[model samples]
Target: MPDMPALHALTRSIDSLAPDIVTLSDRIWDFAELKFQEFRSADLLIGALRRNGFTVRQDIAGMKTAFIGEFGEGKPVIAFLGEYDALAGMSQEPDVDYPAEQTPGASGHGCGHNLLGCGSLLAAIALARHLAEHELPGTVRYYGCPGEEGGSGKTFMVRAGAFADVDAALTWHPAPFNGVRSTNNLAVLEYYYRFKGTAAHAANAAHLGRSALDAVELMNVGVNFLREHMPQDCRVHYAITDAGGRAANVVQARAEVLYLVRAPEMSQALALAERVNQVAQGAAMMTGTEVEIVFDTAATNLLPNLALETAIHANLVSLGPVPFDEADLDFARRIQATFTREAIRSSLRLYQIDGDVFSNEKIDGTIPLHLGLRDFEGRSHFRAGSTDVGDVSRVTPTAQCWAPTWAIGTNPHTWQVVAQGRSPGAHKAMIHAAKALATTGLDLITSPDLLSEVRAEWFEKIRQEPYVCPIPDHIQPDVGWG
Candidate 1:
């Protein structure tokens, strides 16, 4: 445990700096930029860190928006990772029941990444200031990770050895509750399968035409049946990206389907992906079409670290949850009404939260330490999705904490979530998160013994084989589209 006075003082200091942090969050929220396109958000965070006396490095890992800011020196190169990317087609005005669109069509900060980035920056700056004042005997690095929402931005950074030298890393996300990520996440692989065939007039010469679409449909059917035999937790989803020619009178010559395969471990995911490829091949052969597959992206599952998680949970308990006002509660109630009654009940049950209305009602904000891993629910149940953070845990000791920045039952990638991105309750949550993260960084820096234990445990639990990149080196990030 850390000194109570020091931790309390740090928390107070962070609270005092809430206005500045909230301003940053608001600016990023207003920008509402997409993954790998967080030019303004990244610049704002980097510029602020530089002003605070940290040396800055832009374009780390060959990414234009990716950057690293560092301060202090020596053992335990602790890094704080930050992400700032909005979702597509989620723009909305603040605090409104009716969806107030930003434009006819555009992106919005539906994921609360604006808060994610600024909260981390606040932590980094606070920790840097603490180190300078106390002459702390360790290093702190702020990683401006971009494209977290489906961009595999951190995976590329990891491949480039951006985090190779770091002793430990800490990150946080904006969620409906405050808790440490305990369970492992499913590994994922994404790719596109295409079939080529001869085109001919559909009505005049139907026998002369070979339909590539038939191969795609057959492949999908085969994989759908394979799901019955696969593990219960394993997931597979696909979307037809192309169906060849548009003319109804012509047979389709080329067709493509984007597929995402996920499992409890990377090895399983890879094996399943290979099986899916075989199914595609069989379909092509049966249909007399040529098949081609292209790898898009891949990510490993999260490796849980008890040591790091304990430290983060302690920090979370000390800092406590954000306090909410009556007005906040009123607004949250309205938002809750927008969702289905069953959704509200399910969300409350998932996080063990209690609330009657939609307005932002601040709940208890203490990180439960003794909560066993088995007691923690799987993320698969809460809004089905995958993250590249899963990859980071495989290589190093890593843990992520979630701070309640949204109303209960607020779903990500929605206009409602975007509306709450800059709310007072959200701002308060980010400030509290910054304090917790900074305090944890301090603990790692001051306690060399703790870092060693964490590293040892991480190594013991990690797989023996070297990590294989899911996306081949040939596929570069297409930032323009994301």
Candidate 2:
């Protein structure tokens, strides 16, 4: 393990604040606000940072929920990126194995971001306390990043120069396994295609009414056909946000659909987005309807730092496994029962774990809880999903870990995740992640050699291909709640 002065003090500080941190996480879970609207959730974290004696700033990048909290002065600044947003229509009763919503048609922490935000907060608090006690020269910052669910909150923050001065960044996610997130994820671009035409009676004026709904359908078809010609790694997904009208007797006057294009690189994603736009234009010409393309948001592809990942992996190995008791194990088993065999297999594949290791010798048996850390590979891998964190990575050296909070094979953005949001196992996972992050922060603050190595790697990568913010300058963050 890398040596640092008084590492125990940082871990002990986190342990002392365990109860309060868990309470904060549970409160956020209860609030369950959606993207760009996490007012109550942001307030709670901001209040905690202020009480800890850190200077706080709000409304970053013109975003109401985005903020930053800082402590200490000067170079070798380390930042902890925090997220506290929930998914739409995922409300569920806590501790329930089945799908039982606490509030119908409301938001819920289906991705366990309640734990994610609080864990990062606790890490920042512990690091700040250690720095103040030791009179350290470096600064510790907590970035209250909201709207990670399709909003690209961090991307806007990066464009606004939020992470320009930081030397290195650390973050962790609540996952089903404990390991370093040593992977390269895709970059993405999102847009809304709206078509307008004249509304008329379906039977009496079918020829006069150029149906906007037809244009929307044709656009989707053209994009589908274009898919076969694009790169295999690229992906395109869409959801019809507005389908003209419910009545079939009337020719629809307006229709809209949202498109998300993703690729291994930002340039590829941007080029593919233009192709998608051309398809939309073709559809508009075919149907004689006026089309409007509105930009939503965008995120860059992640650049992994092996030096930072190795340091974080050392801390995780030192922290050992999460202390899961019988009650926690029992709850995890019940949650695993709710998952299908295919889901379990898919999750196992994602984590690079064999199925036999998760099950006993019996034909039908329960999947055990993953209390121990997986073997660290210390290699760069690929993940199909995209994150706004990728934007931060482009600006500076960034590393993140995956701490096991849910049962094995419990996928995110599901009722299973919401059900276990407030469980004892999840709280333990949160604290474990905090300790790991804090210890890594200590190493970075004390060891200039390690920080230099991390930066050297980041510099070389960005030197080859300079980063350009995918979101254009003319577009502003969509502040509407809908």
Candidate 3:
């Protein structure tokens, strides 16, 4: 168990701050800002941090929405990573099972980032209070990271050396279950392949035309062929950003496609990227067109630290489970009715849970939420999805936990998640996560040997395979990229 005084202090602080925290999260959910354009959302978090006695710094790392709030002064600086950006075209009415958009085309918190950011802020505030009351020599910082959806906001922050001085970092995601993410996710690279060629009318100058659309088609075909020979773990996906024009009669003069490549390791991702580039070059040569490979953004694979995860897991065990009431369970069952049984099984598989246990509704009609904590036996789970958090883990000893903020089978970036964004259950889960993270923060701050063990694990891993920011220095966080 953690220190009694520190635990009580954190719990007390969270209780006092619970109402305001819930209000802030709901307001951010309303704002639903997207990517670097989260002006109102950033202002809201910044104002909250300042009001709570945290010294705030804005516009760091060349991104307007990116900022940090710090409290206390001294040796062990613990950071809580928070994100408030929402996904586009996901706007939905809260507490509704069916898809009803709040606005026709506006954004929504499909990934529960509103709960994510506010929960982290709550943890930071509670930890700061604990340090101040105990006269502890430590610093707590809340990182207001924007653009997590498709925009690698933390990756850019890492390149600017934002987290270089922090001893440890903690974060949490709003999910359907409570568990620590001890895993190595994929490293991803995104690029735009724009092709240029001479435009000519279809009937008048058939011989003079070099269709860029043809080049795009050829390149996609080439990439499809390359997929068979590449490593099974690597992935290559593309979308036709531009097909030149809607006029089928005209020979297209320009075309563009966005490609996202992912792999288990950065070296493998880079190598696969080169092979894809070669394929693009070959297509351009065959079509008599020039191709431009514009670098979009990238993030390195995760470097998991078992020591940091163990501390957070201990706190989760101590906290037992989120105090979800009957009303929460009723809402969850309603939301679960919208999705299929297979979706619940898929979600269980993602978390490495046995599908046969709770997936069948006949077996347990009351399995609305997986309220118990999962055991983290010092092993890394293999997560295929990528996140900018991977970049932060490469630099500092980073850890994150998932809280049950939605229904049991609800996946992220979907209408179902948006529907439950502002529910009472979501708010309770947010507070539950705050307690876990704050207690873990207290552990690192009060215990020197524990912090040293965490850092030792981090340093040893990076020493063998050094962390190189996958996003090049030349690429700035361009707000208009998306």
Best by TM-score: 2
With a 3 Å backbone cut-off (N, CA, C), the pairs that clash in candidate 2 are none
Report each candidate's C-alpha RMSD, comma-separated, in the order given.
4.3, 1.7, 1.7
Residue 105 deviation, candidate 1, in Å? 3.0
Clashes counted in candidate 1 amount to: 9
Name model 1 segments beyond 4 Å from true: 352-384, 463-466
Clashes per candidate (backbone, < 3 Å): 9, 0, 0
lDDT value for model 2: 0.90
Better of 1 and 2 by lDDT: 2
404-447, model 3: which lDDT tens digit per residue?
99887788899999999999999999999999999999999889
Error of 2 at 92 (Å): 0.8
What tens digits encode model 2's per-residue C-alpha lDDT throughout 255-314? 999999999999999999999999999999999899999999999999999999999989
Off by over 4 Å in 3: 354-365
Instruction: Name the weakest run of 10 consecutive residues (lDDT summed) in model 1.
Output: 365-374
Ranking, TM-score, top scorer first: 2, 3, 1
